[model samples]
Target chain A: MFNAIVSAGTLGTALDSVSVLVEECKIHLNDDGIAIRAVDPANVGMVDLTLSEAAFESYEADGGVIGVNLSRLQDIAGMASSDDLVHLELDEETRKLHISIDGLEYTLALIDPDSIRQEPDIPDLDLPATIVLEGRDIDRAVTAADMVSDHIALGVNEDDEQFYVDAEGDTDDVHFELDRDDLIDLTAGPAHSLYSLDYLKDMNKAIPSNAEVTLDLGEEFPVKFHFDIAEAEGSVTFMLAPRIQSD
Target chain B: MFNAIVSAGTLGTALDSVSVLVEECKIHLNDDGIAIRAVDPANVGMVDLTLSEAAFESYEADGGVIGVNLSRLQDIAGMASSDDLVHLELDEETRKLHISIDGLEYTLALIDPDSIRQEPDIPDLDLPATIVLEGRDIDRAVTAADMVSDHIALGVNEDDEQFYVDAEGDTDDVHFELDRDDLIDLTAGPAHSLYSLDYLKDMNKAIPSNAEVTLDLGEEFPVKFHFDIAEAEGSVTFMLAPRIQSD
Candidate 1:
């Protein structure tokens, strides 16, 4: 029953959000909200857990899910508690399922996977153009901007078939441009957008620097990120909404 | 001037070994234990640095390259430092060039570049076969093994054209085998070797995960890792001597 995103990021530290579910002999987990699922046989190992939460209480099918005291589970799991890991165990005496992840392990907290509102509802975005580049390039751009400011502008010029990512502030300015010749593909036309250096960074998350990343852009919209999980036949995608500008 | 490889390792927690030389125009650094001669402008930036090491008691030369600390530079560039960044300006005051980054200033330290090993001589290794994989795959393999143990064994079987990566331990056991059908390409024979997981992680230092990586393997010998820094046209390599079996 320990399933749900448990991250509240400040800065510098990494973001870790995981969801895990247990049913009889099966355990499924998708950490980082990227839907990279892993199934491992429990092999008869039993755990004691009790927790409660709104996400778990709403479930009323044949079984019940509960909100776990993620804080308490964090103790047994070590520093993993900072990220809000929940744990839940089914109670035989009652139809209630007990869960504990963080510290409030009084009952299992059920979450409406659909209602939790993790991925924002992305409209049928008509991206005017796109550029596929190495994640490191974006990282470098972001870091370069970070040297001076907190945001960067991204755009593509169809005439030159060139892509530009630039950030400028009082003390420093960085501009990285690439012609169509360098990329797997570069598609664009008179469209540009500015996104939070942080959000763009979040979408990239823990992806390796040299990994291939596709950037889809609109005048003022979200960004989509996709990457592969090494040997496994799986991929993860993250789409982050854009932040409004002050001026 | 301190720029040396502790060993090949995954660039983790910190790149651990990224540095830059700062000077107004040129500062005659030392010819000591390990002094760096500017090879390409690619390895460093054209201006501004929060380098890690402090250059002290520098000797003279026609040109100068001050060895700044990598971590210190990152800290300043990352804005983690409380002290004002120490900026250096030289006046050709004698043979010694003094410099500082991020507030902590010191008289230049001199070293003989000739005295320091430029590149250690790596024997012309007769590898069984060489294969290239997306850099991230190797990074993931190391991460996967890192989660479970300190040692990982890599092997290839020619008959079926398959490669295997296995890690066995009390808490975890993982074996991943990819046949020719699943890989970019597979050349097999009885070529195999076991290396320290730590060194493999070390090779990741200063490199991003998505860069193209080539793995050179022999039945029971050192593994040489080559990384192509995407678009930079620069390459970094690590020659990891094999770990001898205790038995």
Candidate 2:
């Protein structure tokens, strides 16, 4: 059995982060907290998220896995205000998740865990470049790039210790560069990669504008974006494969 | 030659009002003001709008008729903010309208006034019921009705001096009533007419929420909606043919 009360904003953000990659996921509820790891059907992107017990107003569990429809949960969460407290309860007999917010009760039928795809194993890699900055800066750069092309190149200038995003169209191009002074932190290294803007646009919505987003980069390799939520009580990491640049 | 500087909001509202009925129109520019009267292609609805010279920040014009594509003008207006000042100029030699807003100049090709539909004569009707209320209240009623049915019945209760809007769906219905206290002014008469919600929804966008909307109604007759713009310096009137009630 499991029950918890959490801020609507935190749950909504967490669901959004996972929903961008997969429609359904298996959320593991344990004494430690709740966690989900899933990958997109195209195998081009992956998301892993965890929320500690401290993130919730109240949490109790005996450790079990619950299959959830992230899209349905997101729809219910959309009705709640940011400050509203959401009550969650599991009905073992009916295998449904009950969510209550602002006097509205939504009962969602749980998906069968056996029907969902197995979670992807997180890989280990030595990424040479690391940059941390405000999420809004990256969001703005991606939005500007969308006006020009379908793909964007992210690169670090080792000599100048600057990070830049560039997108070139048939006749127009957009470029945005940020020096060390504009970033929260930077570990300069020679790194560059091209990624599809379609995934980045959806991921941007899940991230808060003011929060710090740490990016790990390598040449033509998958990129990792990590950020904290629920006042550091939760963390979300997204990895997206680079698109082959056809010159 | 015609040149004027008007608030983007006023121009946007004016364009929106006419665009609902016709894509292109003949704008009558006079020493006193500018006006346009056009009917929808289906001839089911008509819009009449006037903006006095006092509505513009600066006005200078010799009387002339200029053809305008309201859809194209609305697209240019979309680039401006509500408070921004939009400069409009006519190039007599090129027969084009130049709209300048936020450092961007959009030159629109004008159609010959001779090719456009002639303005319809406004029909004079002695409607008995006249109810004046906030535009938002009626807009909300229309929106609610849209969810239940495609047509809405607007009438006044002669006995209670109350104005009401009613809509019925296959299995559900919605009704909203307002007494004299809820309206700015109410002249109750035995009035009832059914109107298409599709037209009302589009027309609602042109009416400001806080502005007073005067509704003129008669049993099974065309309905008239009139509202002011540019702080009473301009006015817009919409007349829609009543839908024949099938019961």
Candidate 3:
């Protein structure tokens, strides 16, 4: 059994972070909090999220896993204002989630966890470089790159101690860079990879503009983005495969 | 030659008011200001607009009419903020309009005035009931009615001295009324007519929510909406033919 009250914005952002990669997700609830892990059909992107009990205004739960359609949940959450509190309750008998905000009550049928794809193992990679910056900065870079090309290159110039995003289109190219002076934090190293902008653009939407996002990068390797949500009570990490660059 | 500088919002709103009914318009310029009269292709709606010299920051003209694509002009105007000043210069030799906002300049080719549809004469009608209300109130009623039906009935109750908007759908109906106590002004008469919601929805988007709109209604006659724009320096009147109600 799981019952909790959380801010609408928190749940909405968490759902959006995972829905971009998968339509459905198996959310594991325990006395401590909730955890979700899923991967896209193409296996090009993956998301792992955690929401501690501190994220909710009131919480009570016995460890269990429930499957839900992310899009439907997002839509219901969209009906509430960001500051509004949303109450969620699980009905074990009917296996449906009860969501209430203000005076409106919505019932969402749950999907069987057994019907969903098995969660993939999170790979551990020793990335050489780490950079932290405001979400808006990264979102702005992704938006600019999307306008110029289908793929964008992210790299760190160890010598210059700067992180840069670059894209090349048929007729135009875009280059944006920010040095240590502008970034929240940066660990200089030889890290560069090309990634599809389509996935990055979707992921960027879920990132709050004011939040500080930590990005892990390696040469020709997938990149990992980590950010806190729900006032630091929850966190989400997104991993995206790099597109091979032809010399 | 005509050269003028006006607020982006004023120009955008003016263009939108006419574009909802027609794609292209013949703008007549004179020493006093500009005048535009356009009728939709089906003659279901008509727009009469006037922008005086007081509406612009700077004005100069030799009196000429230029045909322009309203959509294209709106697009350029949209690029600027409401407070930003936009400069417009007519190039008679090239038959093009040069628009400059901030540092960006856009050139739009003019269409031949003679090739466009002729403007129709404004009909003077005697309407018994006149109601003045906030634009937001009208917009809200129209929006709610749109959700339940394709057409809406607008009328005034003589005994109650109230204005009302009603819509009946196959399964649901919406009725909204505002008596003299709630409205800015109302002159009640036996006035009632049904109108297509599709057109009202488009016209509502151009009306500023805070502006006072004067609505003139007559039994089985066109409804006329009048509102001031550009800080009273300009005004727009829209006339929509009523849809005959079936027994």
**Candidate 2 clashing pairs, residues 3+ apart or interchain:** none
DockQ of each: 0.01, 0.04, 0.04
Greater-TM-score candidate between 1 and 2: 2
Cα-based lDDT at residue A128, candidate 1: 78
Give the range of the ten consecutive residues with the poorest summed lDDT in model 2 chain A.
Answer: A167-176
DockQ of candidate 1? 0.01
What DockQ number belongs to candidate 2? Answer: 0.04
**Cα lDDT of model 2 by residue, A1-247, tens digit:** 9999998888998898999888899999988799999989988888999999999999998789999989889888888888899999999999999999978999999999989989998787689999999998877777666755799899999999999888776534556788899899999988899999998987888888898999999999889999999899999999999999887
Q: Residue by residue across A200-242, what tens digits does model 3's lDDT show?
A: 9988988888989999999999999999998899999999999
lDDT of 3 by residue, B58-138 (tens): 999878999998877886677567999989999889887877765344566788999888997878888999999999998
> For candidate 2, what is the DockQ-based docking class?
incorrect
Q: CA RMSD for every model?
A: 19.8, 8.9, 9.0
Fraction of true A-B contacts recovered by candidate 1: 0.00
